[model samples]
Target: MVNDPHPPLHEYQRSGDYVVGGIVSHAFILADSIDFTIEPPPPSLEEVTVVPKNYQHILALAFAIKEINENPQLLPNVTLGFQIYNSYFTARSTYHATMLLLSKLERFIPNYICEFQHDLIAIIGGLDAQTSLYVATFLDNYKIPQLIYGPAPVMNEKTPGLPFYQMVPKEDVQYMGIRSLLLHFDSDLVTVKGDICTGEEKLENLPGPFFEMSMTGHSYSIYNAVYAVAHALQAMSSGRLHHKAMADGGVLKIQHQQLWQLHHFLRGVSFNNSAGDMVSFDENGELVAGFDIINWVVSSNQSFQRVKVGSVDPQAPPDQAFTISVNAIKWHSWFNQVQPLSVCSESCLPGSRKKVKEGKPFCCYDCIACPEGKIASQKDVNDCFECSAETYPAETQDFCVPKDVSFLSFEEPLGISLTCSAFSFSLITALVLRTFMKHHNTPIVKANNRNLTYTLLVSLLLCFLCAFLFIHRPEKVLCLLRQTAFGLIFSLAVSCVLAKTITVVLAFMATKPGSRMRKWVGKGLATSIVVSCSLIQTGICTVWLATSPPFPDVDQHSMVEEIVLECNEGSVTMFYSVLGYMGFLAIVSFFVAFLARKLPDSFNEAKFITFSMLVFCSVWLSFVPTYLSTKGKYMVAVEVFSILASSAGLLGCIFFPKCYIIVLRPELNNKEQLIRRLY
Candidate 1:
């Protein structure tokens, strides 16, 4: 009788006879048990039969109804009845069942709000997702409460009249539970297959048929749905039967409007079930607890037992949401009980980077080596970075090593050569100074402003000594003193030559009696010339120091593999100003001496001053282009070479002949020999 087709309308009418309200439940009992093609040629009605396991969903609903009826606290003095229907898992059958619940008539009417049977309060159970969705469309128009007991269907539109609620969690929660189980066992590669159940298959040897039941998820949903509906009704009744005024003979009638109030009441309902598990619904009418994860482990006898592995609770915090027993999971025998690799490509090694494969996921990529001068220290790096200027990539391109600190140190060949030359030139200047002091009273020594000659020799000695500052790693004091000292000392040297040239012109003109130039031919004129010319250079150096003085700095960008430590002339303008002033003195001295070169004096120093100034200007003019073209320590070397070469030119040109006359030819150095040669 239970396996027979749905009983006539009289059977369902009997359910409403002694009940104050009716709750209808629909299940796909017959259709789910049969094997049929999904595409062409629909199966005939004769091919379908109810599987006993699938009928458990209907039984669960029935148990809830019986439980509610027995509870005196829920719906007191009234019986809550339920009508169970077989939806056959088809849209047509589910729609017909909804129409039957709506009205006893055969024909359907659109916008049917008025209930033919006021005893029907809420509708529950459409175990198939599509069937539930189809039934929900019509029930929503009349503001009916539809409690679905299956995978929650996605509803795009909301109708005010349809208050649909779901007892089961959404399908995504189930997927999450399955994903957590797979991740727990570290099983990467997995195979999945699905089979349809035929009614002819024998379930005798199966483990209670519950494990093999295709609608097991729906059965559990139905179990929860029954308890949910019972609780909702109990909350609505509040331990009393809700009824209107007596219709006849003290029998009370329930209004359709009053039954619709269950929709609002059910939304706020929450309670613990028989298992002490809390059950509640969110604002979307979906269960909040999500799903329970079950692992089906195959036993040694080839029989399978279900193990509770974990649960996915969406309401909980993310870290506490998906809990699982990782050790309890059992993998397939073919996998050799080890985790499998699931990536599309192996990971990139150190010194290599990942190149993502086009039209593929991020997990799939190609490994490429890092470019030259760049390195990837970590494995699977997406990009490589370049080394700093003072560092270089290692052989494997996995790390950067610091390059050696380089400068014009005194230990190096170039630095040693420049130092030796500076010292040698200084010694020669000292010798020349000693010779002039020894012959201080001689005619040739005192002829060309003797005081100015001493000043020039001292300045030349200092110029040679300043070259030593450029031979080592620059310090702050060295940087400040190097250029400034070079400028002032060279200025004094050129100023002395200018004074001598002027003295020679004045001495030649003062020979005429009563000439005004006689007064300017003394030591006062030469002293004033040297003092005033040197004072202007001292002022320029003072301004340069006050504004933007030079400091020690390292050149990291100029050289690829070395840090060149040198002086950074803080202001190029001031640096060139110093050089320009010195050149100005040299040029003026050269012109003066050139004009006075043919004067009638045997001891004329004009030709020597002109040649010395020419050499000074030539060396400096060439120094500019050479200094600008060089880099690193070579730049310092070029400047040092220029200083020594120019200083030596001035010393040999201006003072060497005077030394020769005073030391080697002492007879010619007397005043009589000088006056006789001049006349």
Candidate 2:
């Protein structure tokens, strides 16, 4: 046991039978220097400074008891008294103060009774956790109720109860608490009209620099703590008086043994305060209350204003728990009008995806755009996906757009040009064939095997018509005939030129003396050449259709934003083989026509045949590289254009002069004029 030589700052007053205990930290100590020696000087007022703000806590306790004593509706017959001690903010002083409340002065014996009628009911603890802990530990054995009127002790579940009870709620409750919640326990202090400040009147004025030394956060808690003890004691005394169950009691008498019963009454106290808010406690002795959400705005003059912005209610459903009205918030001018992005990495926008950074947190990432032909439907997606077969990725890659039906159609500009060219050439070929038929008896028309001429012109007409197969929507029949038909038809036209070349050579030989080549110069030899060369190409197309034929298919990869309805050649080898065969026939005809160009006979036309073959080969030769370089439906257009150009080349090169003579120059149709040109 220790004895103090100097008197400390302490206050005590006896007014009634019941006494309440208080331990408040009214002053703090500052040791100017610590003496490291074994014996140190005792703490005194020379080292201690009183806190002006903390005087309000002790004042709240005094005012609460005064308000209760003056209220007639509450505690009609009972009066309450109190003993307050300055804790000096030290655990040793706090515990020593708690002992004085239990034992009488000059009697150091344990369990000594009070010398007066004042019986200690409960203690309002010191303003700090460590001080309250020391006071509670000393008072627990006696079972006296200790109400903590300070900040709630931060204790975990396994921390074992430190303070006897709680006044404020746990710190974690404020994260999800109600708005505008406080106590009415000390709001009437300013209206108390008389000399209410006691010895601390200098610190009691409102709107002053020290904030009137008013009831702060902890002071409010102290006010509520005092009201709680008063309510519990009144209820306990009233119960005994109303039931008349107190044996040997006229009104209500509280002994040291029955003080523990006040814990039960205080634990069950659930009345609403004057603020219309419930001053209730849960089973764990935590205050059943809430917290208000405030936004701190610092103005230009450095004035701080707290604005109530939003709230979070723990009792509400999860989606509705947190509610905010953004328009109510006022932002500083330096922040700009829009709220700035403050995240480590902003979320990836649409048309891009999140790429996690190596060796970094998950929130830290890089954003990359979606690959071509793919789309991301929402922001922060991990990867982009391809659209359905009938759709394509939009330009932004944020969504999929429906694909347009694409092919070489007659309505579009390219289609209209190809269609007009094909029909114009066919009409020109038909007219030439008709002109030859009407002038069959003439010498120029009868020359160069008229039957072979007719066969060649008719095949060229069909070749021009073949270009229509590449236009419009591709079907099963159209796809089958599109490539193969053009190959076989062009082959017939080339073979006719070959036959006509052979005929001119044989007839030139027959004009020699006693030549046997004249017997092979009739229609039999010409027809055989046409049939044999055409049959070879016909066999190739037959094998193509029988083995790997063309079929209608949609091409999505060839174009970024379209689906081309085209013919997918089943076997690329066979399709090339068909084009190769036509090239071979044209080559053979060009060689034959070139050799016989100088033949002097009047009927020989090998020079015209050579020029037509040259035109045909030039058109198809340039078609290959251009066709390979282009994408989508443009590839089909190139092939169609090649067909039209080559057919027109053969028509113009071979028959333009002949038609000029027959229609415009009638004298050139005579034997004399032909003989003059041939010589």
Candidate 3:
């Protein structure tokens, strides 16, 4: 049945007597030339300009049917037939054509008796999206299969009882083809000028008669639709014939109502087409295939030629989806063969970030330099990041460089000065020890327990040497030795001072009658004081090392541009405990020496011990705030300075007077002078 609504129904003809199937195709014939100046856009009911190439789709469909019918293996003992129709490319005309195909009556009434029995197995035309949609609504009610040759609109909530399959790929996959073409030509700005149905006249004057004009996607879709239907029918027929031969050895049953089986078989069908390309359908009944990208190359004669430059395969992985042959693309004359940039703004360079513009595409952004201490290593970074703890940003803020490691190194000026001072003080202490040895028998030398004085001088020498440990890059061994040695040795020195002060008081009291303090005025008491006080500090240090010992570590957080290699005090409480014990000994010695300074003995050394303890306490008291306030290597410098200054004070203040008496006032060193002063 030919569904032409015009008066000239010359192309409409009945099917052959042995027809087994039907085909519906839209071929518009121009009745009159349309006038563009007509108002109201020419009534929707009027005849419009017709395209002659639409007939090529019809011919392609007929050729496929002919090829399948000639092959005995495809549909044995069966033949295919067709009923052509012209939709006039309009919704209302396509609806009337569908009504006529379903029933011979002029008007469509649901379940009405028909004048003729039309064995229409399937309907496969209506190339326009709107026309197909209108036809699909009616055929779906009766489960008639509709094969569309172009992209169909999404179906509404109404159930499509029949299978409505589209032969072309979806719109998104088509856009991928367009994008590949743009990239092939290196054209950033693309203008899509017309609708899908409108053809460009520039494609005319091609090589062959069939290629006289550019073909739309609908033409290729029609070619594939014919092959798809043929494959489904062959599979259905073969199954039916096998079942009949196995069960009853009878003729195969082929009923028009079994078209639904063909629909189900088409969903899973896969085969090769005449072009040697695999054809199949997705779950949504749309063809699964890649899109071909076409580029228009302009020649010197002002003629354009279409070239295949690329393709986009939606079924491929994301990275390999779109590919193009860039060398084959021909740019416009104005480009001078150079590629064009199409972004909304210039790309952000290195060391700068991209700030997204509001209400704009991702390609449009503002370039911003990275902030201080932060870096953007890559181009067009969304935000800059801060450098790592042990690193610092370079001058350009494009790289992160490792920070310079710093410590109180002996090679530097500060370390050199501290070390020289320590050696100088140590030498002075040695000189004082030598002076005492020379004047071993002198009254002033033997007045303060001579053994205790020697022990104090040796400990002060060790204290001066311990400051060397803090002047260089701290190691684990030095970290453990410096504080422990300082604590133990200084304890011995202060304990000796306390012993001398006690001895002075005891000797002064022993001069009276029946004084019992004479028993304690010997070396035995002084030795016990030094040993017992040092043992307590030694115990504290042993426990401290056993539990949480200090270790060498890098101080990254203390300074921004430098990594300070220093000792990490493992336990703050234990460290302070050591300092507290030393402070306790100093305070006790200071008070005892202060009380005993006015004793009535010409040989009393309490005045010197009192002044030495006062100096020691003052140096250390100032050390705590300075050590806490300073940072990095300077903090270590302050601690080392305090150690040297305090040790020098003890050595100078307590022993300098004795050296003066022995060297300059040698007359006062005799026992006769001491006894005369006592009288």
Strongest candidate by lDDT = 3
lDDT of 2 at 580: 90
Q: What does candidate 3's lDDT look like per residue over 309-331, in tens digits?
A: 66678888887887767687666
How well does candidate 3 match the true structure, expressed as C-alpha RMSD?
A: 11.0
Error of 2 at 162 (Å): 43
Could you tell me how far off, in angstroms, the CA of residue 666 lies in candidate 1 after the best superposition?
2.8
- TM-score sort, best first: 3, 1, 2
lDDT of 1 by residue, 548-623 (tens): 9999998887876788888999999999999999999999999999999898868667888889989999999999
Better of 1 and 2 by TM-score: 1
How many angstroms is residue 260 displaced in model 3 relative to the true structure, after the best TM-score fit?
22
- At residue 121, give the lDDT of candidate 1: 54
Off by over 4 Å in 3: 1-349, 359-364, 367-372, 471-475, 512-514, 600-604, 663-668, 673-679
Q: How close is candidate 1 to the true structure, as a TM-score?
A: 0.53
- Predicted candidate 2 versus true structure: per-residue lDDT over 316-429, tens digit per residue: 677655555556655544446343332457768899998989987555689999998789988777899989988888899999998887888999999999899999999999
